[model samples]
Target: MIDIKMLIELFVFAGDYNWIGKERAIKMAESTIQYSNPVIPGFHPDPSVCRVGSDFYLVTSSFEYFPGVPIFHSRDLVHWKQIGHCLTRQSQLDLEGCRSSMGIYAPTIRFHNGRFYMITTNVKMFRNFYVWAENPEGPWSDPIWPDWPSVDPSLFFDEDGRVYITGTGGFFGDEPKGIYQAEIDLESGKLLSERRLIWQGTGGKSAEGPHLYRVNGKYFLMIAEGGTEYGHMATIARSDSPYGPFESNPDNPILTHRSTGSSIQATGHADLVQLEDGSWWAVFLGIRPVSVPFSGRHHHLGRETFLAPVTWTEDGWPVIGDGGKIAEKMDASTLPLAVDESAVSETDDFNSNRLQLEWNFLRNPQDEDWSLEERPGYLTLHGSALTLNDIGSPAFVGRRQQHFRCSVSTLMSFDPLHEGEEAGLTVYMNERFHYEIALTCGVEGRRQVIFRRRIGSLWKMELVEDFEGSDIILGLDAEPFQYSFFYSLPNGERKAFGSGECSLVSTEVAGGFTGVFFGLYATGNGKSAKTPASFDWFQYIKS
Candidate 1:
């Protein structure tokens, strides 16, 4: 059998002279190349990727979620696996009283000298810092606070062994808004040079998310412009030196979907990577918005990470996607496709001593409110005084709703003592905008099942029914436009209870950076409950 490596080597050696060799090689490798967009889907925004040899590592922004900065590992760049998170310990991230979208923002991960560094800003704390680790799935070091005062921090390790930090400027007192850069001491987090305004974008609003790269003996400064909305775009500038009198690309806005009727919108905040095959690809954040009648476009899944191929022009500028645009499906010749089949599981039985990497809390959780070993084979959540309506962290644990059409169900056993005590499934967007189908004790301590919808300040109990059993199965079926709620008994038939409009919890209506989460929650409204809620199993299947 002829080796595939030898065939590729022969094709390269034949160069432009042998068209037959090139065609045969391309045909032989075509099956392992094609992939869809949003390589890492659902609420994973502000993506940053770094390549180490044949392996690729990626990290995304996790706003107001405990265990911030979800890290992923991939070999083909099209398929990704959640290895672990960069900030796992409380000392690394503190989201205690943070608002829905005001915790971690735009983390840039880079590997230098065999060590991995993730730098980002905690908007709630108003600080810029970075954590380091030897391994991507890690026990990362405590954050080393830098003197810089900006969001979306990125580090560039130069060939001269010097390090430069770049970020969105003008957040400091009286500084003009633009992309800013400064040389820094990596070990001590001290500034080695004065902060300088590098390049004001090409007359776009809110020029931010800066990253610097040296390619073909010239420094390229790339940034996102146009306010991270429908008009969002990625632009680039080139200069002879790092601190530059730079020239913008003649065809600016390297990537965008603005002013178009495409399904994907808000495309920007991109990071570039050069693969081992010397091909260039970019990872950017874009939202897939579903058009609703009388409501324009609404995206409930938040900004997702998208991949696009990059090609260079004769004049030394990079053109992204197809003439500054990308679709839901993309065709590219990538590394041999490798997928981690066990990365995302469809069902979690709650039998392990610890929760999986996909599970995340709204904020820093109180240890006494949740337990995995208390019931041996179930997840027990003690009803906390902090309800989901409050801005505090309640007894809740959730994972991102990754698909537009999916089914999520959980088997819960709870015995409520007070009228306000409730425990069950929640399709949560934020405190003010969510849908909950819970098992609670109604007035006179009567067992009941209630479906409530909270839209801003208006709260309504849409469905209520008396229940007689201690164990119930709660389920949520999500479509592009609506979410249907259901409940059932063990090994029994399912009954539809109510439904909620998906547009109500979308970023267009709710006004947040996060997506919807299907969670299990236990709350006592205003006081602590005497009973605990136990969840036997949870299943999420993408339909």
Candidate 2:
């Protein structure tokens, strides 16, 4: 509790670390960003960017996390604040049974005329849809389901006001082969043309995430290939007409790390944006791997959003980064390092009427099951019937475990009347893989703190200790491979538990497309609870 404010205090007083007074603490908080490359960090992958006026907006895929598709706004294109979510309403998306990496796929955001349009595929719903808002910050329209069912859908608006939706579709035997496009009646979400394959993408596997654009009167088609892993790549094609007969760039993949010994890998699924000064940029997804490569080099942080410079060749083909590679350090003149410190805060005060955009539920949550205003300050999560491992939506809300070496702690209070009722912190990967430390009813009507891990088919309580109180500050400090759990009383010393391997809840082990999430949960073990478990505050500090 000595420094519970966490790294946020660093940014708050970073400018004046030699603080003379408390008032200066508030004033100097807007210190310039001091982050390395991959401008936006942790699990924010499949980036699609667009610029309207001087402001640049980016959206990333949020698989299985309700409040799907996070919309980030950046003035300098380097620093970003999540303005809102494109799919905020239940009518907009339903991820009730979505497994990890199986909800929203790649989304492309565009601003045309007066409205901002965001289109993507809801894999769980098996539909490609788009939502529009006059203001990018939202009150966005509900899901507009286009008739076509495909992943990685992109919307293009032509100069003559015609519209098209391009995506990874059409099957070659069992595998979905090539990129497809179809003219669409934007107003009614009706297909105006038959869905047709446009480009197969330089003979790479899984040609997908097609974004159509017009540069200098020629239509440019950008796509992702090689299946979003170490072999991932960014490829392009160009055509004279809106719908093509497009020819692949001879220098096919415009960007990729591929066989390079570099740590950043899986570079593809990109979106392009042009600045007012005519500077070109590409926002794509990539990952920084740890030391070990096989079972050990797990990317617990998931695919992150990266910014790279794009230089168009004399013949009009684009070259990403310096030479078809993702640079670890981005140049200053290009992005300028200016960031709003609020975009990536280490702490959430939960002082607003609504939950912050950073908080996400396991699935489409029952609206009344959780609240911020219900308790004025603390987040009150009423216990739900589902458990953490259940396919049904649990009363669990969490944020992406953004860093491998970070500490997340929460102040929680819950009184369990039955033996199964519990509430505490959880490191959730998916329904089949997760770990939790909870305060629950134990033997002899005594309250106890417990540790439960559900990995693969095994589900068991690992440890239990009797507790005399309801309120406990639960903490977990994570490293790349290991994480230690701890609990502290309101006035007592912090108690540390045995450390666990980070791989237990990883993509390599859990077999999913998402990273880990540090979140708060309340559950009655498939039954309702008498009262709600309240989380006073949560802290996320990069270690």
Candidate 3:
């Protein structure tokens, strides 16, 4: 068998003829980004972006995860720096009984007046609201508006200083749903007019994630339709007015993956930005399910962020997504530099602002419950009732694992588990697909290293050792979508156990529309047990 590291090296660098060409082009592009480049990867859904001078700020939905909107900054709309999370306050959301699939939906980020605003839906609570900040890093204000029956809310400001919010709520009778826009008073947070239903959708059904943009005297509304399933798509409509008797783009369903092959399912929820050069590009979410006919298990590499160039017609409407079908490979070389060298850092020294981009909570974050400075050297995670189901739980932090061939390793030591205490690292994909290495106290007052995995209907378990140790390395090696867990002792011997060679199942295969994530967690099972866990650090390498 070929060595995994060698195979990756060969795949990435084997061909030499285009190295200089690739490097020269790539270098030119990196020059534009002041911070990091290719800022994020894989399943950063419902992206919202706003440009303020030379800097660009972006946000994405947290859905059953806390830290509701993740805020990122960029200079060239390329390399993004994760600045902070927008809704860190508790009063902003309630995730009780929030299933793994519920919570915040598509969010819209906008800059208006003197502040920055983000609007989104809390699906479980059935409300649409907005959060704003004077500065991007934010002491963002709490939800100023709440409990409206809408999801995917986008805010629009017209020329005369009128403010409007656009979103998708429940269906209008049986016709799926249409974009709804209502006049809003920015200062008092009041809706001045009833919601006006506009842009029924493309010829297909299920319209959502509406973004309103004004270009060359016309108001354009871009949205995704055809459900977020196999036929996911992005379409456009335009009107002389923001409220719209809008006209659909003749080239409706502007972007898609269906034509290439059903296997490359491209569902688009897009945001557009015009460059300093006046060139246009759209940052949207797309899917490329790995499984052929859709299985009940794994869909490893779907639901990822994709960028495409856009050309405006003489009529001023924008076209996107390979124009019609996603390209197998495009001359990304032609694109001018958007970021300065892909400067993203996957390694964490634990000394930055909170956790690196790697860490994510299960649901909305409990800000007071966590601190990077309290422990100084270690991350302190307080326990919350948010087991695995509540998207608003307080005891979970995770990061995206993008490369198929990579290794994730972390160091953890706990306060010692009593009866109900559990803390560990995990490779999680929904509730159904997860593998964990935990430190739990045994019945005899000793601790044990327990490994567990959910294999179909049963949870398979194994014991590496009977709690004889404290400091240890929990590592996961992933090749393609399959993962294997290992324990590297302080002395450096690797032991494989629990959920051996398990395939990661995502919404694309597991029947949802989300992506895969690996996380660290601590749980208290009703019994009185002190939370005994301090994580040293987490490391990921593309082997």
Candidate 4:
């Protein structure tokens, strides 16, 4: 349950800390810390973190899900609270072609010049954009610029106060590509001059998601390459100039899963931050092999975010992962846990003013079209045409599949006797791998449940029809690589709808290199696809 009382109390403390001297406030926040040295699962991939005095704000990519960019605040960088969503308006995102795995990519968060800025890449449309706000709790500016061959963009304001942008090229036809840089005008949301490709990637044509940092007297450029798959890695280079002929580290790929070969396949995309005590820590994305010992079957968890401490060697290069795989268990000598343990919330009542921070939209979201408070006590979803595949329609909403054993249920009703109306739950990824249990309203009034997994552009689909489609309960049961569907009939009896063995593959499996997501969607197919449908409530229960 959410601790409303504690949250209210924290507000009072936050205000008091501002009035206190910097040293005094830092001491006060540090003194109350109970949990120190948070271990594994500290955070997820594509992490964006910023420190404001003693408080820190962190966010992660949501990709095609609305309530995009989940925000969290923490005093010790271990315990966190979901504050709000950064991209709440529809104009800020375009999701038409955004497969479940596409949409938002790696994001970089920075605080500068009395404002907070977030820069991210959208791979589906291949554009790099930025959002900013005077306050972190924001009515943030909509994204600026729409199309570019940019992926994984980071912003750096030099000592002279000139802002520069760096990113990896999106096109595959590479001409010895490396990290590139250009002067950028924040006000106009435009690149002022031509971009310079700084360094050819250390490896083959896989370099992307570059983040630039200036520390000591040298400029460090960090990047992820070898694709986001078994060969994923983190490498770095350094130069005296921001636009540089950066020299790759003698021990390049300072962090990687490559040493474990195809077995522990890990992809590393990292963001670096300095702790309040001046220690350097890096938060990056990585994944372990599903079936250990290098089996090619049934992978469990997908790519996830991780934190590794960094130490600067006498030679000025950065060392990560402590000379082994990211240490899963670390001694809690630095930051202790305030509570014994904490986990991300996995349940929803549909009664809050907003969807839980875990909920996201298919692409960018349109606020006027959907409401969690419309029912006042349940989630209300409005219909949109953007089907799962339409980049123009906004017909999708989703949450991450954080557990292998979990059940998703939804309460839904369609406009009675209206033809071509369908609404229900879905485990979606791209146009291909997805399953849905739908309530269809028409003269026939059909309550049909279906399952579909993509093999390419084509879908393998199975449908079972019997129950009347008027306001029914639908459920999807998933365990590992298998799935079973269930629904309650109007007669108040339960029945097995259908079942299928599936490979939980997404755009990543299809070679697009993106994460998978499962959520709820309402569609009119393609014709009259705008017909409105609503979901009373959607819930995820971990059994």
**Per-candidate local distance difference test:** 0.91, 0.83, 0.69, 0.65
CA lDDT, candidate 4, residue 169: 67
By lDDT, the candidates rank as 1, 2, 3, 4
**Residues 54-133 of candidate 4: C-alpha lDDT, one tens digit per residue:** 76777777666665676667665666667776777767766655665677777788889888888887667777898998
Among these predictions, the greatest lDDT belongs to 1
Candidate 3 per-residue C-alpha lDDT over 1-543 given as tens digits, one digit per residue, 9 for 90 to 100: 123334334434533455545455445443332322123565567777887776778887676666667788876555566788888766887766677667888888888877999888887877878888999898888887743457788888888888888888555355346788888887767888887788779767778889998888989999988877667788999999998899998878788765555444655788888766777777777655554334432455436555667887786778774565554343343343353433446567576656765467765565654667776777766555444422345476888766667888888777565665767777776766667787766666677788877644566666546756677778888876467778766678888855554344666434454566777777664433466466778788887
TM-score of each: 0.95, 0.90, 0.84, 0.79
Ranking by TM-score: 1, 2, 3, 4
lDDT of 2: 0.83
lDDT score, candidate 4: 0.65
Flag regions of model 4 displaced more than 4 Å: 1-44, 96-102, 123-125, 144-149, 170-176, 185-194, 259-264, 292-302, 336-347, 364-376, 381-394, 415-420, 441-463, 489-494, 502-511, 529-534
Worst 10 residues of 4 by lDDT: 34-43
State, as a TM-score between 0 and 1, how close model 4 is to the true structure: 0.79
Cα-lDDT of candidate 3: 0.69
Model with the higher TM-score, candidate 2 or 4: 2
- Tens digit per residue, CA lDDT, model 1, 170-247: 876788988889999999999999999899999999998999999999999999999878999999999999999889
C-alpha RMSD values across all candidates: 3.9, 6.7, 6.3, 7.4
